[model samples]
Target chain A: MMIKLEQLVPRPLKDRLSARPSDIWNTTLTLEPGNIVKIKAPSGSGKTTLIHIIYKLRQDYDGSVYFDERPLPAIVENELAIVRQTQMAVVFQDLRLFPNLTARENIDLKRILQTPLYDAEKIDEMAERLGVKHILEQQAGICSYGEQQRIAIIRSLIQPFSWLIMDEPFSHLDNNNTRLAASLIAEECKKRGAGLLVTDLDEDSNFDYTHRYQL
Target chain B: MRIQILTTRIDINFERAMRSLNTLLKKLIRTATGRKRFVMAFIGLSVAMLLILSAVQIQVDYNDLLNSKTNQDSIANFLVVNKVLTDRNLGATSLNDSEIADLKRQGFVEAVGLLTPSRFKASIQSASDRFPFFTDIAFESVPNDFIDVVSKDWHWDESSRFVPIIAPNMFLDFYNFQFSFSQNLPQLTQTVVKMIVFKINVYTPNGIMTLNGKVVGFSDRISSLLVPQEFMNWGNSRFANAANAKPSRAILRTKDPGNPTLVSYLKEKGLATDADKTRFSRYRHIVDLVVKIAWVTGLLMFLFAMVIFTLFIQLTIASCKEEIILLVTLGASPGQLRHFLVRQFFPVNVLIVLISMIMITGLQYGAHIWLARQNVYLDTWLGPTTFIAAAAILGLIWAVNRVTIRKYIRLSTN
Candidate 1:
């Protein structure tokens, strides 16, 4: 699977962030499977907005983003749901977990909808490696920011996907925890032959990305 | 053993939570159940009253029509055709066989009936009467379907001891208002008439034979006193002179009495029947007005109940908006949400309908029994019309509730 962006220009709003020089707004880009790419940008460079538009979550833009040669705007709702469920996974910057649910349940909620793509044992194994196994049984709202970030990352990786998109996933983590979460994400991507698109303000030595872009 | 049981229980809990989002939905419904019941009670009571009132209204009007004593012309398509009297005629006009055959051949007439004159002279006397009352009576009959009085006793047998008679309602009015006023006697009601049997003495060629006569019913449409056609034919054959017998009146059943051809043909033949046709028209208009008014009132009540029901649904859905949004974001379809709503609301409405119908039916039966003790017999059960009407209203409530709940779910998701 591939996602292609062509001459995309978002309708600029005053409150939302947009890239400097507006050059990235008029560019064309493509993301292929099994490739790790880093999008390096400043704090207010519309990074999260770009990720949202590509994931078919936002449509306030001028040009097209195509999924397998079909435009995102034209894809039917059921097909988009299937793609989101089994082919594309995302970790938003806000860690959109149900506050009433446990940290383990936040991840298990996505897994339960699919046909047992990842079992409870696999989930426990991932949580153990990411150093969040002790906090798994606690309510997600009461957990620390760094711990919840790791839980959101684990939740995104529990389902099958051709592309795992992360928007500032390790923003709240220290170097050691960031490296641990990055290692787990890379290993899971390699196992499934999926691509990685991670957005961050600066580079860290955890990931040996295949390609890099600046916004 | 305790550790193993604890592990198994955990697994069951996990499985139940993983199946669907019904756990969350159940929690939401439980929280709002009290408020929902309070609102639904008002709607249910309104609907129940609407149904009961409509059913009672229909039954009462039906009974009124059944027992009405007004002279309703055009109740049947048949018109009584009699020869119009003129100054030049000093005697009664007789309709011969050829005239009846000609009337039958007319294009507008569906069928024709001829009146048969009684051959024997008859007189009536009662022990309560100060003087004997005698009359020359004739009997005319159409098909049994044409008779409006619904009674099973409208039959005759030659060997029977008592003669069952149907008399014109006007004859009773004349006796009560005019004759009884002039004389110092008591007036009679239909119930009293039904109870009094007169002694009839018939003057036959052989001798005078005494028979018992009982009035069975009264008809406003036919001006002459009526007897069963079978008794009249047998009596006429046994007593009357065959050569001189003729029918002076003819009854013709027409497809449409207002048709110009039929009217002009009757005019050409100098035949006329009842002239008070406007009274029948007014009676029909009144019946229609009563029915329409009842329907409109019932419909307004139903709409008001529906409004209350819809508000209740909207409130319940609004309270569960957060849970609904969570479910939708988890990839639950709108159709699934609709199925959930239907499952929740359908059984409640069904219970309401069943309970309301039972109460209304009980009320009807109670009224019937009480009235029967006072000598009035009403139908003892709710009719199919009541059931059908209730079903229609319930189905409407279900449909509207489904749509409103589904819309709220979608709006919350968005």
Candidate 2:
């Protein structure tokens, strides 16, 4: 699926965005499938807002977003849930995890939301690769921010999707851990021939981006 | 063949996995927060259901007792009705055409047979001196359907050798107990009485007419001596000095003698019947009152139980509102949540109905055994209407649960 943005601007930052010349805001941009697109934005620039608009989490935006020629706002609730389960995945910047659920359970929920894409062992494998395997049985509430962040990433990857959207997913990770997490994400996306759209504070060598933009 | 086997194995595994997934959903949505309220509501529902179903069963049992062949009396279905004797209507107690027509029009009255009394004077005397008896008597004739006794010789005509007569059983009892003792006569049995021939003397204008008469049967329904309708018509026309008088009494064939409506109708028309036969109406009124009370009380309790159940559901949902919203945000469809909630709540309703049905069945069996010892019979099982009522109640509960679940799930999701 291709993600198309036509003159999209968040309503809260509409005035500030109009005064600036940017590659994404108030512009028509299309991120094609199997392309690693990196969007670098400074703080308070509606970076999370942009990701939410494309994911349909927030509707307070100008212009329209289309997912493969169908308007985003036209989808009903159940159909939208299908899109979320089978067509798109997201890792919120806040690392939204059920505080009471253990890390493994958190990932298992997404895996079983639809049909099983991978066996239950795949959760242990992903947790082990991200070096948070020891915390897999621990409640998400007690885990550190970095541990929760890695858990959230694994949860997003456990489901079937054609597009992966991340909002500063590596914010709480160290250099080596970020590389490990980034490599795992890259491998999964490559296996499915899916696209990745990531927002971050600064540019980095994350899967050799096919297109880089300043949001 | 190998591919087919592999696909079947995969299907089995998928089914197993779905079961586990439901278990996970159950754990996430804990319905145990309001355990005490659920128990109270369950008790209330069960009691209400029992009362309602018992009402249905009681009415069915009462009808069976009244109409069942084993419990029915052969003579109870026919009632001999007459006008109440008052001073103002002393000699005018005959029923007119309009009154008989009105009686025929009543819903409970199946058929009416007017009792035509003999208009001329009559006397009967024993033919043999060994059993000498003489007395003035009156005869009444009624339609054959109203007669409880079956006799082959009950028909008569002008060319016949003798007239057939039916004596009331009360007359024989009176003679055996009182008259025979007072008159120093031997007590006779029914077969002996039936074999005796007697002389009948009808006083006509020209002279006294003599005919032979014999008793053919004994009746427990009508009190007076009965003759065939044809004989009565022939005799009244030939030997009467005055015009035929209107009938003063009628026998009614009815399906339910105990029906309150028929009893009240007779009273309203200033008519009287054998009170012993109509004693069932009083019992029926009492039963009706009891069944109606059960219905009304059961309905009120059922309404309160339903309200409590709905409120309990709302409380459970409201307590877990944030968890539900988060679950929905994580791509849980409204349908999935509603299914899980209904599964959580609806099984208890079905269980309540089933338990109520079993209890009613047990009670019916117990009553059947107890009443059987008293020579009164009822069905050993609950009636079909009770089962239908139970099924209807379960369906109503299911629909309510579905609507409540859908509404609350939508509210939280929005």
Candidate 3:
């Protein structure tokens, strides 16, 4: 099933409006299964806002989001998380790692999360693949910045998800690291038959533009 | 279909709630382990305080009520006096046989006997030895205290032809030994004994009494020796007995021989005793005082403790609000957050219930033991039953705390 957003935009935007009346009030986009697309915009653009929309936080918008070709316009409240879990994963820019949990603990959060029973072998494999196997037991806060960022990405990617969403995920990575992360993410999405929607201006990595929406 | 949907939704919610609870529990443990001393203090104090107060009091009261002397009802004798009725004709006196038949038919009485004076010169087949002359007293079949009035025998006595009944003061008074009582009365209570035949007298009524009666077959206390009214009648007729008379003195037994109730029932039936009135009143007063004290103490303690507990919980919840808000912000739904709060407080409630039960048991023990010392007895007070009660009490307390926490959520939402 594909999700299509027609003329979606923000409301009066009381908190984030540091400027005058804006015409970026409406925009249309089509989100399909396993489609790798990016919404490219400047730093201050509402890319994160757009991402939060899919997560159903800022719902004050005039958009028709169709799922399975049906207009899921009202956005069933509790089911939004179900949609997020089976349909999307967001690697937030802040890397909200629970400070109390170790790296391995952080990765294994999905086990204690919505799902019951996480596989130990799968967790170990993901940790090894992300090159964080050695530092799995270390407290997340004590790890270096790059290590924290990698752990965050690995945590997000470790679980099986049908859609991948990110807000400036590569902001802290070099070109080579970005390429490696991109390749790894692509391999993961391809294997799961997942869709990808990323919003960032990481121009140097030169992602073969699947599709781009300018904000 | 609607039922099916509701079921499915409930199932999913149940699952979500479980996961949410598990997550919150694990988080609480991880966080709480760093501050073990605080938890230990709260739990330890709660247990100790509750156990001491609750358990001990329950034990003491329960014990006292059980072992008291008159636990079951009782019957008290108020005034029992030996008196007789007489007709001023021939001095011979005895209860008329027809009256005995009438009393027998009444049927509310136990055993009826003729309680003759010890000196009564009547021969009973059940007696061990033969009684002798005027001064020869027999304790076998009569009230021993009547010997003091042994001065008289009621018969035209001192003659072998007619024997007198050794009826002591009662016979003399009833047959009117001194002329004003009865014109044909026996003269000189004793000298008249050998001269004429005197008869023993008795009146007894009928019923089954409710005392856990002593085995009459073998009880040391026998209030009255029974002279069969049949025998008394035979003697009265055969001796051409003294003046005719009416049946006068006999005792009746009643039912339900226990406190307040027994007294009232007996009073209602015209069988109450003066002693019954006094004892019943005392019991009512003492029971009323105990009940009033228990209720007043229980209410005051409940209200004061509840208020303090509510305020303490309000403060603790307020302090932990930030932690709750943080969880909410992290994509925790309202349901999840509520479950988290409930789960976090789970251990606290368990500790409270456990401690309350322990303390309640102790109180019941004290009550039971105290009552036992005072001779009280009971089978149950603080076993599984008390644990259930404590759990219910704690559950209600927890529910109240949770209801208050919703306001915190509403404020945070706003």
Candidate 4:
């Protein structure tokens, strides 16, 4: 599956936002399966908002988004839920973790939501690689911010997705942890032959990208 | 291959998950514990109101009154049918031979007897009283078959000049309670009154004769004083002015006093009856009104309970808004959320209804036993109408809960 953004221009933020050049603002982009795309922008430049619109989480944008030539907004809610469950996975900037649930339970919720349920061993292996296994049994709310971010990343990777959308997922992680998390995500994407869209403040050498866009 | 297998299992898993998830949701809500008190209090209040309304809506059995009035030899099957007196026909109220024949022809009437008025002029003089008290007395008689009580001693003997008289039961009550107290005389029992003798004087223009009179029995059926047919016939021949007095009232016996045909027939013929069973019809009307009022009040109480329950649910959802939003974002369908909320509320409603029904039934049974001890018989359970009404109200509560929860979930999801 491919996500095509046609001449996309997001609804501007209410507060301060860095001005986008006309060419970049009006650019059309398509992130296809197996393609790695990076969106770099200054803080508050609607980078998260662009990812949200592609995920159908927000609709306050000027242009249309098509998930494999089907208009994103026209899909019904249940069908969209199905799409989100099996075909798309997102790691939100805020993690969106249920504070009352342990990290393992949070990840298990996403794993059981889709087809070919991920085994517990596989989840623990991924958590071990990202250094979140130690805190996996603790409630997400009581865990450190960096530990919560790793738990959120593990949750997103356990689900089957044709596209993995990350909105500043590694923002709270140090360089060592970021490189480790990036490598695990890359390995999962390569195994599934899925595309990746990672939004951040500046370009990093953690992922070798097929295309780059400024928002 | 994996997606195919998973898709095949989705239906089964979804069903199992819904049940499991609802159980889990109940556990989660139960932990909140803040709203349980309010829910329980409202449930108790609603159940109490329902019990009362259900008890009232039940029909009363008038036969219970018969069972309780065992000492009263009530000839309830007999009705005293009389005609309306009018100025145009001053003697229209008299029961003539034609009217008695017409009454007997009716299918509902089993028997009819014309009342015979006394032919003799008579007055009673009390023998047991310190001061001699004499009062004019009237006598009426029907056939010996119509008399509720019969004894050989009730016969009159012209040779001995002894007459046995049947008096009204109310007359005994009046004398014992009112006259006896006011006159500083002893209140007499039925047995004691039976032992007293009286001087019944039969007077004519030719001569006045004194005869021995004794109280034979008390009649609850007849309000006026009565004498044996033989005595009335003999006295009328000797002292009466040879005028054949037309009977004014007739006693009619029916199979069922509440038979609508009897009432309609009486209405059509402009006849009236002074039977105790007629009052039961009026009593039934009053009971019907009472039941209606109770049902209306119960429905209002149910509405009030619904409001309380709805508020409890609203508070519950509001407290858990964050968790609900998180679940929605995790691809949980609106159906899942609805199932969860419904599970939370439905049990409380079922428990309330069941407890209310059981308590109401038990209360009715207790009341029946209590009344029976006091020689009063009453129906002992919630009637079918009450149960149906309760079931309907319970169903409405469930429906309202579903709709309200669905709406709230939709808003949260959106």
Interface root mean square deviation per prediction: 5.0, 1.8, 5.0, 3.3
Q: Write model 3 residue lDDT over B244-359, tens digit each, in one string.
A: 34533434332222245444443553332345323545565576566566656655555555555555545555555554444343334555555566556546756766766665
As a whole number from 0 to 100, the lDDT of residue A108 in candidate 3 is 60
Give the DockQ ranking, best first: 2, 4, 1, 3
Q: Give stretches of model 1 more than 4 Å off.
A: A13-24, A114-116, A119-139, B1-19, B25-298, B315-330, B342-347, B364-391, B410-414
Backbone clash pairs for candidate 1 read none
Task: Tell me the deviation in Å of residue A70 in model 2.
Answer: 3.6
- Span of 10 residues, lowest total lDDT, candidate 1 chain B: B64-73
- Per-residue accuracy of model 1 over B135-160 as CA lDDT, tens digit each: 65545554455555665667888777
- If the candidates were sorted by their TM-score against the true structure, best first, what order would they fall in? 2, 4, 1, 3
Higher-lDDT candidate of 1 and 3: 1
Better of 2 and 4 by DockQ: 2
Model 3 TM-score, all chains together:
0.59
The candidates, ranked best first by lDDT, are 2, 4, 1, 3
Q: Tell me the lDDT of candidate 4.
A: 0.76
| lDDT by residue for model 2 (A82-108), tens | 888888889999877888888998888
Collision count for each candidate, in order: 0, 0, 51, 0
Against the native chain B, each candidate's TM-score is 0.51, 0.94, 0.45, 0.52
User: A98-163 in candidate 3: lDDT tens per residue?
Assistant: 666688777665433455333546667766665667888998879877677777787667665777
Q: Measured with DockQ on alpha carbons, how good is candidate 4? A: 0.20
Would you list the C-alpha lDDT of every candidate in the order shown?
0.73, 0.89, 0.52, 0.76
- Which residue segments of model 3 deviate by more than 4 Å? A13-25, A60-78, A116-118, A121-135, A202-209, B1-25, B28-70, B76-344, B362-370, B380-387, B397-414
How far does residue B382 in candidate 1 sit from its true spot (Å)?
5.2
